[model samples]
Target: MATSTEHLIDIDRYTGELIQGWERIKQSIFVILTTRLRTRLMRLWWGSKFNEMQDKPGNEEVLMSSMMAAISAINTYEPEFKVTRVVIEDMGPDGEITITVEGIDLVDEALRRLKTTI
Candidate 1:
């Protein structure tokens, strides 16, 4: 039979491993913002911890580049965009992510565009 101290040691090791795994999960969920908009948004979201998450997501280099592409597309494609709030809701899938944005009738415009585009 294992002693109480031995059980406690095993529990501590398990907790550490769980914590590390959770960190990896958190890294995956964060979307990098490359533009000045993103910088401001990140500041609003996480003030002090922004720097910690900066380099972890692929040094935030590739991530930033990808975001820049998206921002560029938004400007080029949707010039009349008057988006007020951008909401990214996780619709629980294996690996599929659904990005939902709610704004001033822009959602309808966006859906129409998507239908035409895709």
Candidate 2:
């Protein structure tokens, strides 16, 4: 009989490749579902209008909430994207939080999707 370790290694080897392939599929699926979405959000978050929204506290909440909705949508659909880090640079009067998604590759993929839209 194969030892448990042998079974584990076989399982790991099989699933590892499967998981890697799934990562690409998930990203592609996310892009398909949210390409326009990512663009709209980039414009919403990084656009000059976001800066303008900073002028008022109430507007800030609205802006951040809108941005948060966008993010939540992405996370809801793409659980594998795996955000490793987030940075809140400014919780301004509008309560804007500057969020940076971790994983440069994920960031780059998202940027690519947004670029196609913008």
Candidate 3:
């Protein structure tokens, strides 16, 4: 298996420890999902359009759109993580949504899961 290393963004909290392999890939996925598209000056194409779904009615159409946006973002940004499945749940009244992403870590050859709320 191959290894990829990245400096943890929160160096102060981590005490300068480096994130490697699967963990690094997982972190990258979260970053890509949370970021708004075109927000980054240099990397204008980076990030997911999932955030646009916010404030919209959480109907089936919106949910499916959100899921597709997530898959597209991960597929484009994190080539090392091959997404196998994406699950989105509407968390009721508050309009909160939870996204679960499952994929294969190409570098580690292991299954990995990431869950985040949007």
Q: Give a tens-digit lDDT track for model 1, residues 7-109.
A: 1111223354433222321221223222223245545432122223233334346444433443343433332333343332332334222343222223223
Report lDDT (Cα) of residue 77, candidate 1: 32
**What is the Cα-based lDDT of residue 68 in candidate 1?**
43
Question: For each candidate, C-alpha RMSD in Å?
Answer: 19.9, 13.5, 3.6
lDDT of 2 by residue, 5-100 (tens): 211111123355433333453443334334443255544432122223334555456656534544554454443343333333444555444434
Candidate ranking (lDDT, best to worst) = 3, 2, 1
On the 0 to 100 scale, the lDDT of residue 76 in model 3 is: 83
Clashes of 3: 0
Please, what are the lDDT tens digits per residue for candidate 3 over residues 8-94? 332222456766566677678878887898999999988999888877887889888988998989988886788889998554566
Clashing pairs in 3: none
Q: Report the Cα lDDT for residue 57, model 2.
A: 56
C-alpha lDDT score of every prediction, in listed order: 0.29, 0.37, 0.77
- Model 2 stretches astray by more than 4 angstroms: 1-58, 84-100, 103-118
Ranking by TM-score: 3, 2, 1
Output the better candidate (1/2) by lDDT.
2
C-alpha TM-score for every candidate: 0.25, 0.28, 0.80
